[model samples]
Target: MNTRGFYDELADRYDLMYADWDASTTRQGRALDALLTTSLGPGPHTVLDDACGIGTQAVGLARLGHRVTGTDLSPRAAARAAREAAARDLALPVAAADMRALPFADASFDAVVCADNALPHLLTAEDVRAALAETRRVLRPGGLLLLSTRPYTALRRIRPTSEAPHVHNGPDGRTITFQLWHWHPDGERYDVELFQLLPSGGTWTTHTSGATYWALPEEETARYLREAGFGEPVLHLPAATGFHQPVLGARRPVPHTRSTL
Candidate 1:
């Protein structure tokens, strides 16, 4: 299925992957806040969540008082994010846009975030570079860029097939979710099948979705960040950040010139 269709199928139920999804937004938001503050500074800064999905991070960041705008390839997902924000009485401007090509002015934001393993969705080096270039273009000079993805360094060798099932209560009843990963021969790409067993009246119903991602390692990702105009890219492991995935923190370099006699 196409990216938009695949996410559209999963949008309404996406948050069920987490236990207490709302609380997770706050936790992830605070974690990102600490990272942003430690590197960028303490204050209300403008942020763009380029691959916002259903606005989990965007809403949380908005609650934290950061001017946040979000975009996603799936129109349904973007709309859902807007509704989610509104439900919380937060104003989060979410638009439908591809990460590879953003529709925003240059240097318009203090930070650009592509969290929740969003970067890997681009399966090729060129595609990743294009998205990174756009992300850097939207950030002000010396602005921060944060991205999160699975620890492919170790995950690559393991080639994990699935994750533990996450069960959550839905409007009608309970929902059980899990994913099965199918690795490509190249070892750098994987096709994932997301399955959900949802409650329907007295019986359970099964729904499935598909997606592909590049198993881009930390070293290669950092190199791509530099190629895309970010400097001093640093890899932060989950153990250190208390996040589920490793996050890469980098910044746009401020232009400087030496005085001549």
Candidate 2:
């Protein structure tokens, strides 16, 4: 399946990927908020979760008092995000939008977050640049951009074919999730098959979804950020940031004003 179709199909089951969705949201939010605060300052700042799926980060950030807006490429996922936020009584405005072309005025937000390895789905350098340019355009001068992605450095080296499964037991039953990776010969792109084994009456049912990604490591992503007009980008690993994935941060540089003639 394509990216949108894959996410759309997985929207309802997305939470199943997490052992405890609610707790994951809170933990991720705390880490992201701390990272942002340390990089920028304390905020109730206007923020955008550009690739928000089922309101994970957006809802958590909103709960922590930031004014957050969420957008996703999948309409179903966006709708699910909105509903999830509403269910928690949080005000998160969500819409279906492509990251390469956001529907907002220029310099509209204090920060933009494209987390959870979303950018690699672009699959090509040109597409990645377009999205980064759009993200930079939406940020006010000196505004922050937070991006999280898988550890592509080692993946490029080892080329693991499959990920370890995560099994979760809830009140209803048990579910197991894992991924299979098929790398292209070029060594920079791969197709992912996400498999979820769900409990059924007397039997287990398997559901599968697929998408492609480019193996974009920190150095390459930072280069794209700079090319798209952001300031020098910094990489934060999970060990240092307490985040689940590697996070990169960059800022839009403030323009210099000329002295009076």
Candidate 3:
């Protein structure tokens, strides 16, 4: 099965499934806000929400007065995010696009954000670097790139049989499903199979999909960021700030000009 297609199919119900994860969301948002305040100073402005699933954080940013452009790999997710933005009476440009090849031009944005362990979706360190490069390419000189991801060690602690329940409203009806998963460790990689149960009449259809991604070390992540032309990353625990610890903040390097010889 196409894992990407599964996410697209699950987009409508995405918010409902994770609404109860409020504590986690609040923490992450607060951390992000802190970084924004410290790095770029206060103010609402244009920002890109890369891999914005269902627009939860994007909506929050819009509500905070930032003009947000949210992008997702799934068209269904983009549609849902756009609908949410509309419901809030906010104009958010939600586009269906790949992170590696962002459509925006260079120096087009003031900041770029990728939250909720979204980096892992790329499945490789090179993909993460490409995404970061695209982010750097689009952000103005000295602009910020804020991203959060679960540490490699954290994934090891997650129980194999864990399942999270999510609900979504669709044209057909309310679709409620459980995101059940079993984590299988392979060296530094985690093979994750996610199961969803869809209620059809009285019967529930079980759909299984999976993806594999490297659990990269923080040192490796920092190296990639530096290689991609980002400044050093600052680590902070999500529990401390109500978000992922060490919200990586990097600045786009400003090019130097040679004096007349």
Question: Which structure among the candidates has the greatest TM-score?
Answer: 2
Model 2 scores a TM of 0.98
lDDT of 2 by residue, 22-100 (tens): 8888988888899878877898889999999898899889989999999999999999999988889999998899999
lDDT value for candidate 1?
Answer: 0.90
lDDT of each: 0.90, 0.93, 0.72
Q: Report model 3's TM-score to 2 decimal places.
A: 0.82
Write one digit per residue (lDDT tens) for candidate 3, span 186-252: 5565555665556677676776666555666566677888989887876666666666344666788
Model 1 per-residue lDDT tens digits across residues 1-261: 767788888899899888779998898888888889899889688999998889889988999999999999999999999999999999899899999999999999999989988888887788998999999998999999989998898899899999789989767888899999999999989999999998988998999999998998899899999998899899888778777789999999998989999
Candidate 1 TM-score, true structure as reference: 0.97
CA lDDT, candidate 2, residue 106 = 99
TM-score of each: 0.97, 0.98, 0.82
Which candidate do you rate higher for lDDT, 1 or 3? 1
Error of 2 at 75 (Å): 0.7
